[model samples]
Target: MIKTGLYFGSFNPIHVGHMAIANYMVEYTDIDQLWFVVSPQNPLKKKKTLLDDYHRLELVNRAIGDDLRFRASKVEFGLPKPSYTIDTLAYLSEKYPTHQFFILMGSDNLESIHKWKNADVLLANYDIIVYPRPGFNPESAEKYPRVQIANAPLMEISSTFIRDAIKEGKDIRHFLPYRSWDYLQQMNFYKK
Candidate 1:
C-alpha cells in the first residue's frame, strides 16, 4: 500500500513555507505522496479572512505545479460544512483503500489537538507527523505514540501574515511561489 501523508490546511495563500514542509516530508519520511488537503472550512478557524475554496485549491495546485509526489486535493470541499478532520479522514480511507494515510500537522495544531472532534480516535488510528511551528513547544506531543516530530524547519511565515502584508500593499513575492504570487497579483486577492 502507498503511504500517503495528508497535509490539511486552509492554504489561504499557499506559500514557500508550505512548499518547504511538503518537500521535507517527501524527502525525510517514508511517506510516498504528500496530498495538500485544502479545507474549505476549518471548524477551528474563522472564515472572514479565507479566500474562496476553489481559488485556494487553484493556488495550491499552482504552487505545487509539476511535482509528481505532491497533489492538491478538494476532498473536504464537497463534504459537510464546518469540515472536521476525522470525517474527511474516514472518507479518504474508504475511497482509497489501497493507500495508508498519515496525518501531517504542525506543532500549533498538536497543542490543541485534544479539542478536535474525535481526537482520541484520530490519535489511535493514524500516524501523525508534526512539523515545527513558531512559539509552539512540541513536548506535549511526546505523550502520543502515533505522533512523531519531523525534521522540517520552523518557518515563521504564515498565511495570516501574508494576507495582512498584501492588504497593506507590502511585497510578499519572496514568501510565496512564483505562480501563486502572480495569481494573487492578477486576481487582486487579499487586498482590502
Candidate 2:
C-alpha cells in the first residue's frame, strides 16, 4: 500500500523551508509521497496577509513542479471554509482507501493541536509527524504519545518574513524556490 503523508498548511507562498521538511520526511520516514495541502483559510489565523487561495496554490505547484514524489493539492479549497484538519483527513481517508495517511506538521502546530476542531479524532485516526520550528519546542510531544517528531533540516524561513521582504521591496530570491521566485516576479505577486 502507498504511504501518503499530508503536509497541510496555509502555504501562503511555498518557501524553501517547507520543501526541506517535505524532502526530509520522504527521505527519513516511511512516507512515499508528501502532498502539500494548501489550506483556503486557517481557522486560527487572521486573513490579513494571506494571498489568494489559487495564487498560493499556484506557488505551491510552481515549487513542486515535476517532482513525482511531491504534489501540490487544493483539497482544502473544495472543503468548507475555515477548514479543519479532521474534516480533510476524513475526506481523504475515503478517497484514497488504499493509501495509509499521516499528518505532517511543525511542533508549533502541535502545541496548539488541542484547539483544533475534533483534535482528538485526528489524533485517534492518523499518525502525526511533527518537525521543529524556530522557538517551538519538541518536548511538548512527550504529552502526546501518538505524535512523532521528525529530525528535518532546521530552517528559520517563514512566510511572514518573506512577505515583509516583498512588501519592503527586498529580494526574496533565496527564500522561495527558484521557479516560484521567478513566477512571483513575473506575476507581480505580493507586491502590494
The best candidate by TM-score is: 1
Which of the numbered candidates is closest to the native, going by highest lDDT? Answer: 1
TM-score of each: 0.97, 0.96
Per-residue accuracy of model 2 over 23-131 as CA lDDT, tens digit each: 8999999899999999988998999888899988899999998989999889889988989999998899899889899999888789899999999888877899998
Clashes of 2: 0
Displacement of the residue 21 alpha carbon in candidate 2, Å: 1.0
Please give the CA lDDT of all the candidate structures: 0.93, 0.89
Off by over 4 Å in 2: none
- Writing each residue's lDDT as its tens digit, candidate 1 over 117-157 gives 99999999999999977766667777999999997778888
